[model samples]
Target: MVTLLTGLCCALAMAPKWALPKILAAQDASTESLGQAPADDPRLAAVRRTMEPFGPIESIRVPGGDTTESLVVGHPGHRAELEVLARELPGATAAITELWGPDWAQSALVVIAATPSEFAALVRVGAEMPTEVAAASVADPFVRGNEPTGQRVVFSPDAGRRLSADGLGTLLRHELTHIAARAETADGAPQWMLEGFAEYAAHRGRGHRFAEIAPTVNAALRTGTLPEDLPPDTAFTGGSAVASYEQAWSASTFVAEKYDEHRLVELYRRLAAQRQDAASEDRVLREVLGIGRADFVADWRGWLSAQAV
Candidate 1:
């Protein structure tokens, strides 16, 4: 999930949010297996070295259910915050499991950056971290082929400062959903659907009203200019990026409501497995949803209008 850096000039505003895309330079398969390594292992020394410039690093192992394990790292001073997130991870993992099932890795890692620079450095997104981005999940794709290695969730310093506990919980669930679906996600998958599916899982049972969360799209629908297609990649990095996320979420929500959650997951698998483009997208729409792209758009627009504030 990419978020545009806020307060940037028009040219720099297009920088993408750092995330684990479907393709990345894979790390050595033997570098360090996740969840199995001890916090004091020599390999983790490198992680500590990388974070040393920021503050004293601390690590904790939080036991998950029988299927998953969790570890969290943060500055010594932020122990309270890290503990809070540690408590949230199990519930987030359970939620994703219920939505997509337990086909993902057996372990999860979370990092809490003490500063914005630390956040940027951990995610390897360069020196200039976007002010608006709250957190990112990253992993090496090449080490395990389609599977991820060294997967971890990194949070911007502002995240803990600004978000309520519940808000942070929702965000963690969103990134965890990405982690669970990473292997199945294709480098060429539709960004809209990817974000939409994650958002659907993140917001499920959160009790947020549609009008409260989708004011931008709702306003557009009231003006009768419904979006004609899924959100383009460009929509995720520059102006209206947040609105694009909402639109994507609304699209996935519509699917879950109109059909069923299982069908939505099936659509994701079908699209993720195929080579996606404008043409393949149309074919996939017909093949999976039994409708043409035009009809899908019409139906989605109608649903949007119905939910408009």
Candidate 2:
């Protein structure tokens, strides 16, 4: 049986709307051997060094078409979680590749933390990692036109306890989407495009109903409280986080519907390359989607209204 998992983003946290196109069936916990650890690869050794301080570690290698994609790592106590992530990694990568294309490294080091300290270390958050985040994608400082290095998705220790197999797959795809798109995504880019694009990728082609995915927005729509504009970056944190995510996803889905998936991606590329204010967003909207910011927001609100009933 599949269950919903609730892992909200702390800062860059992807709230719990993540679901996926592919899901692995229940498996023997021991059957997660996706591949053998390939020789003395430097990346693998580096990861081991980082994780070993927390405790003795174990891993499963996820093979790609020719080379391989990732290694799922965690403590023996969390073997079951590692196994599920290992099994889910391939399909998640495939989904990201399908959407973002085959340009990225297509590989990662997935770590399941043994404790909060371990989680903090893995994601390099110092101490006291944000408890709201279920999983997050991290990478070394990416240089323009260079493949990203040290890219990994670190899962909180409680991820396994909180997320089901299906949830694991969706969250994996969500974080992997961030890893895949990281290079194109500028730090100060609009939050609607950055997080919304990732949220859109996570749910695309997964047969999720609009209301099902954006229940918070649906609730607001029912009360004649449609969003006045795209969720501002400020909306992504603190009290309104869940609602903000729903609205962001809703705005992105509207783009996909009015234009097409390809244009939606194009829009993401255009808008995510820099910080956006009203005028800059208008320029990008006219360039990519051919609608100005006001029209885009108007159309999105209309789209949100249609989904309410």
Could you tell me every candidate's TM-score relative to the true structure? 0.84, 0.88
For model 2 the TM-score comes to 0.88
Which 10-residue window of candidate 2 scores lowest in summed lDDT?
A: 1-10
Residue-wise C-alpha lDDT for candidate 1, range 153-224, written one tens digit per residue: 777775665665666666788788877887777665776787788778877987867865566777787787
lDDT of 2 by residue, 140-234 (tens): 76454545567778888877766666676666777887778777777677878777878788777776677767777887888998888888888
Query: What's model 1's lDDT at 249?
Result: 86
Q: Using lDDT, give the best candidate's number.
A: 2
Point out where model 1 deviates above 4 Å.
1-38, 41-46, 223-225
RMSD of every candidate to native, in Å, equals 8.6, 5.2
